[model samples]
Target: MATGWAGDGAVQDQIDATVKDGIQRARSRLPSGPGLSHCEECEAAIPEARRRAIPGVRVCVACQEARDRDAAFCGYNRRGSKDSQLR
Candidate 1:
């Protein structure tokens, strides 16, 4: 039973929605097709080993790391999360 303004199974609905959003976000970020020879963000040449390791890598390690760091801070925090409190 939901409390106050929330409908039935509201908490579970939020949880499911969160998981679905995460899946879609991850899929959207996946690289597809032929990757560029250099980092798209920094224009640094991609190493042969790195290219072989990650088939569709488009950015160099440093740029990719920076992107991941940025992505980490941009997601929403769930209710009651400590990160949400910090915001």
Candidate 2:
């Protein structure tokens, strides 16, 4: 099937690109190595229980929640379509 566009599988191509981008972003944020004794962001000591539970933990619970809230508001450019760009 064709979308009447330049390519026969343009829709699939777009979907693949979106998925790849999301995967890349997720991989980049993952923590590396062993868990820290203290929170990287707030300098508070990370609990022993938390370190044991999450092996590669970086931030403590409070700091992680704040960081997540901040990340949620970041802008994304999903309007890859030409029609959306014109508006």
Measured against the true structure, the TM-scores of the candidates, in listed sequence, are 0.51, 0.58
lDDT of 1 by residue, 8-85 (tens): 887688778788989998888788777788999899999999888777889999998888888754677456674433
Give model 1's clash tally.
Answer: 0
Model 1: colliding residue pairs: none
Backbone clashes in each candidate structure, one number apiece? Answer: 0, 0
TM-score of 2: 0.58
What lDDT does each candidate get?
0.79, 0.77
Best by TM-score: 2
List residue ranges in candidate 1 displaced over 4 A. 4-8, 41-55, 70-87
- Candidate 2: stretches off by over 4 Å: 41-55, 72-79, 82-87
Candidate 2 C-alpha RMSD relative to the actual structure: 4.0
